[model samples]
Structure formats: C-alpha cells, structure tokens
Target: MRQSVGATDAPEVRPCPECGTEVTVHPWYVTWCAACDWNVDPGAPDPERGRLAQVRRRLASRHGEQLAQEIEQGAGGGRGGPDRSTVLAFGLALLVHGVTVGLCFAAAVLIIGGWHTGIQPVLGVLLLVAVAVLLPRPGRAPSGPAVLYRADAPGLFGLIDEVGAAVGTTGVHAVVVDASVNAGVRTYGYRGRRVMFLGLGLWEILAPQERVALLGHELGHFANGDVRSSFLMHGALRSLAEWHAVLRTVNHDSIVDWFLNALTFLPRWTVYGLLHLLDGLTMRASQRAEYLADTGSARAGSSGAAVALLDRGLLVDGVEAHLRRESMAAARAGGGAGGREEREAAERELWERLAARIGSVPESEYERLRRVSARRGHSVDDTHPPTHLRRRCLASGDPQPALVVCDGPRAQVVAAELAPARALLARRVIRDHAG
Candidate 1:
C-alpha cells in the first residue's frame, strides 16, 4: 500500500536493483535508487500523438534532449555575436516592422496629398486607423492590485538584485505579486526595464533556497539572452498571433460574394506562414536558453536545490485539489450568510493551511506525478521542455554551491514585506471561491 503523507522523518529503506545496496528514500518526497541512481529518468523519449502536433512535439523533444545533453556535458555558451537563428529572428521581425512602416508612409501620403479629395481622405483616415490598431506597441510594466515596491520590500528586492548581479544583469525595477502558481520576468515600458512577477501559489510552498533558484532562473533569461523574450522578437510574435486571430475572425456570408472570402485568404495565410516560420527559426535557441537558465538556477541556489525546484512543478495539481477542498470546507461555511467574518477567517488561515497541505504530500504521490509528467510531456506549455527533462539537465551538471543565499532572517523580512499582498490575494481567493 502507498503510504499517506505526514509521516515520520525516518527514511524508507529500499534495495537498489543494480548495485543491491540499501538505498534510502524519504517519505514525503523521494525518487530513484540513490546507490545506483537507477530510475532517475527511466522513461524513453516523450512521445506525441496526432499528426501535426506529433511532428511539433517530436521536434521539441529532439531539441530538449540535444540541449540537455549539451549542458550536461559542460558545453560552453556561444560567442558574443548573434548566432544564425538570432540573426534570422531579428531579420524576420524587421521585415514585419518594415511592412507596418510602408503602410504608415502610404497612409501619410494619402492623408496629406488627398486633402481636398473627399473619398480619398476618408479612405486614408480609415487606412491609418487600421494600421494604428495593428501596429505593435510596447507593453507597460505590469502592476498588481497589491504591488510590492522595492522600498516596501527591501529584503525581497535586495535578494533579487543579488541574484541578478550573480547572473550578470540589472535587477527588476518593480515586483508584482499575484495568486498564480507561476513566476516569470518580463521587460516592460519603452526602456525595457525588467519586472518580476511572483505568484503566491508557488512561492508560498518553496523553500528559501528554491525561491532563490526561481529568481535565478527568471533573471537568467535576461543574462542568457532569450530570443523569445526580446522586444523585437516577442512583439513580432504577439503581433502576428493577434493578426492571425483577427483575420481568422473575419468572414463573409456572401449575399453577393465568395470573392470577399477569397480576398481574406491570402493575407490570413501569409501571416500564418510567417508566424510559423519565425517560431520555427527560434525554437532551438529558445530551448537552449531554458537549459542555460537551469544553469542559473544551479549557480544561485545550488544544483540540488534547483532540481528540487523543478520537482515542485509536478505537485501543483495536488496543491490545487487541496485548495478546492479547503475552499469548499471553509469558504462555504455559515450557510451562505455572515460571509464577511468567514472570509476574514479564511484569509487569515490561508497560507498556513496551504503550507500544511503541501507539506503533507507523500513521496509516492510525487513519484506518480513524475511518471504522469513523463507520460504526458507535461510542462508550462510546449515552450518549456517537460519537467523531467529539465530535472535531468540540472542533475547532469556539476554540483555548484549557491552563489546567492536567502537566509532565515532575510526570509522573514521578505515574508513580512509580502504580507499585505498576501492578505489581499487571500481575500480575493476566498471571495471568488465562496458559495
């Protein structure tokens, strides 16, 4: 029988199949035969089903394995100049921008030269409006309802800065904390200052070192020069996607015309083709960037801690299920009346309860989830390699001591700084789920 969680600290004794050694595994979390390291990653390459998706998945798997092997074998990074992929991605993005500029110039001529002409001026104004709507604009820095400015969250900000410096980049200018089970960094505003987003669902469960690993992984994107995250490339991709979405929605019922349908086909398919090509060109670089980011994870938080952080991604389903149960049990109390006090109580207990639930997850559950992750090619999305592969990439590397540490005293300060955001998010979660 699989053991339930909340067990004693005693490690379970298991025999290694290969070495016949007594390998010890923990109750709450364990994987593989320690003596021989058997079953650490026993699965074959992840497989894909369906036609087109199958092809894409195979390509992704190939890139993931290739990149993981390269990093594992201590491959050094590229030379400072942009590689072929980067150059192509940039060139394609410029072409996209050039098309926009050409339209803008044409519109300007029509507007300016056709000043006295009636229909031409109207047409010019409409054309310019259409171009303006389609033109890509830089996204502003994100702000959460409960933002934690550096002044208010000095400990957290300081730790992030230290990680950034360790990873060789300027730290984030602002931090937005939300209730998502994810974290990431993005360039925001015209100057492209970095902004880090912290999601409490994941953050609340991480050990201090794992949290540092998360920070390092995110900032590593900047340090490693992720092709997808750049303003030009990202903007182009988003613009193309938006254009695809918009064009796909345009339809003709044809009271008089199938030609209207014919007219829309060329531009729509062109955008689709360009989007596919650009994405394909950047695929290898993006995958490589992720592996390199894992290196950042190791550099800041130690290889063991970085790998452990990846392991945590597998348990999010467990956490969310526990949350639904908690919400049903507590948020629905008082027979749908006196909700204000009930919500307050739920908010007060939110983090502690979540901590206990996650803490109680058994190692067997993690082992099962790992298998599920392997079977399903589970990830943040297709953009990320499977969690197991990421773990492999880190595990394959040389063990590194943490270059940036988050100690107990500093952790407390960081928690205190995030307290208000916690309360607001907790309240929102309870309110949203309450029946």
Candidate 2:
C-alpha cells in the first residue's frame, strides 16, 4: 500500500529505487532521494513514457541532454527548453534593439557631418530630421500595482508553501488578494521577486484540492522561470512599441515632414513585423509552459481535481461576469449604490450558487464548455492551450482517484482563511457598480 503524508513534522519514508537510501516524502507531494540527488513525483508516470516522450527526445537533441533530463524529471513542471522559434525571437529582438540605437547614432552623425554640405544634403537632412520623430523618450520604470488586500492568514500561507515545494521552488515572495476573478504570478521588484495575486472571487468558490491545483499552476510559472522571461521579453517589445507610437504620431506638415516620415517608414514597419512575429513564434513556448503548469498542479493535487477545476473555473468565470453586469444594472436602475450589507448578502448568494453548481455540474454542461472552447480555438494572443487539450494531457498521465476525500477541519480552516479577502472584494463590487 502507498503511504500518504499529512500535515505534521513526521515525514513518511520510502525507499529510493536508484539507491538503498530511504527517501522522506513530504505532505506537499515532494519526494527527494538525497543519496542520488533525484526528485520524484509519486503521482506521475515514468519519465520515459507517454505522448510527451517524443517531444522530450526532440528537445533533448536541440537543447541539451541535461535540460531534457531536468524537464523530464518535472523541473518547472517539464518545460524542456526554448524551442527553435523562441531562440529566433530572442535573437531578432536583440538585433532590433541594436538597429534602433544604430539609427539614432547614424542620424546624429549625418546632422553633424552634412550640415554644411550640398551633396545629397536634402537626404542627410531628412534622415537627421527623422530622429526626433522616431525616437522614444526615456520614462520612469513602472511601479507595482497596489494590492487591495494581502493574505495574512497562516493557513493560506502554509498552503502556498506546500504548492511551491511540490514544484521544486521556494514560495512566492508576496501574496496579494484582489477583487478580480483570476489568479496569476508576476515578477516584481528590481530583484525579480515573484508576487502571486490570488483572486478572492475564485478562492471563495474552489474546493480545497482545487485550490491546491490553482496555486500549483501559478507557482509553476516561477519554477519554470516563465514569469522572469515573460517580463524581459515584454519589456523589449514595449520599448519597440514606444518608438513606433512616436513615429506614427508625427504629422506630415509639408513635403519635408512627409519626406522625413517616409525615411523612418522602413524601420517602423520592421518593428511592427517583429511584434507580430514574436507573438506567433512564442505561442508554442507559451502553450508548452501552460501544459507544464498543469502537470505541476496534478503532481501537487490530483489529475482529476486539476481537470475538474479547469471546467468548473471556466463556468464560474462566466457566471461571475454575468452576475457582475446584473449588479451594475440594478445599481443604475436604483440610481444609487446599494448598502454594504446588501451587497455582501448578494455576493454570498453568488458564492452559494457557484458551489451548488460545481457540486452538481451535469455531463451536458461540461460538454458545452468543451464545445465553446473548441469553437473559439487557440488564438495567437492566448497564453493557454485549448481546454480540451489540457484535459486530454492530464488524462493521459498516471491515473489517480479524481476526487480527494476532503477532510472537514482542514477545508473549514482554508475557507476561514479566505474570508477577509472575499468580504473586501464584495464591497469593492458595490463601489464599482455605484461609480
């Protein structure tokens, strides 16, 4: 019989297959064989097997043996390495940055050298004039957004730590609670601190294990270095966009202005092409990262719970959006903000309805969600794979009991831990609608 660990100081011992040393299994789903430096997931299939095996082999050849091994071992939830497209995108981004700087310098040189010349002086003058129109001025680095509330409950923090450990990383540096119906991990601070934003809207509706899966997905981004890379890539793209925006804003006042604008046209178009190319090129990596996160959730929680959470979470999002619109309409009809107590009561009812629906979601409802997702397909802007693909990937993995038997005391504690954030978000809705 397989032994399971629970919340306690005492760890369960299991023998490592590679060495005779006994491995300690933690409650958070990590089993490390210190003797051989091997990390194992009790819930996953053997690393050498499954539909992902061929992809792993291809990655190993292109990237390196070590990287492929780490991904297979579930490092960062199995994000093997940057594919060919990712490599090309980064290379082109660096080249583009260099070209922009070169353009500025060339313009300055032309202005200095040809200011007193008559040989093609018009061309040189126009190129010089284009500099002012094309360059983006430096601005202050963006500050982090303010959090409406911070999660202080010990139980919630403990849960965060557990999910992080399962994905082979330290817990996030900060956990902020917000009113949005989504949760995400982002890099903050000069040191690239991983700050997790947990939406109270989702927390109030998810079961204990589903919460674990959700946390796992966010934490997995940190493990895979997805958040850090995302920050750098986006920053680069934004810089290019700023330059493009400035160039576009310059009006053609006369023949000279039109000529200067035409002079800068090629580079501006290049920037546009790069942005669209990056979006397409990075889609594969983005989709793979999402799949790896799903695996992370499954290893931390359960496959069945992870899949079910995706379905239920989608349903809840749709319902919450509809209800928010209704609340806003009612507020407008009444010509005033509702009382805090009244808003809170309505929010409570919303949660109650969500929980009831998740509990008894019919087969037809799930199919409907799948059909909708299929019709939408995966757009270039989408960061996640199709919902059906995610479900199929987890289902292909090692089969475990889909539903975990919820222990009452622990579930109650988790719910209580989230109470403060939920209450805050409730009032936020009322204020938003009134405005």
| Pairs clashing within candidate 1 | none
Q: lDDT tens string, model 1, 304-371?
A: 88988888887776667756765665556736677667667777888777876687666655765566
Candidate of highest TM-score: 1
lDDT of each: 0.77, 0.62
Q: What TM value does model 1 have?
A: 0.84
lDDT of 1: 0.77
Off by over 4 Å in 1: 1-53, 76-83, 250-259, 336-342, 378-381
What digit string (tens of lDDT, one per residue) describes model 2 on residues 335-389? 5455444555555554554455445544544665565565444443566766876
Cα RMSD to the true fold for all candidates: 5.2, 15.1
TM-score to true structure, per model: 0.84, 0.67
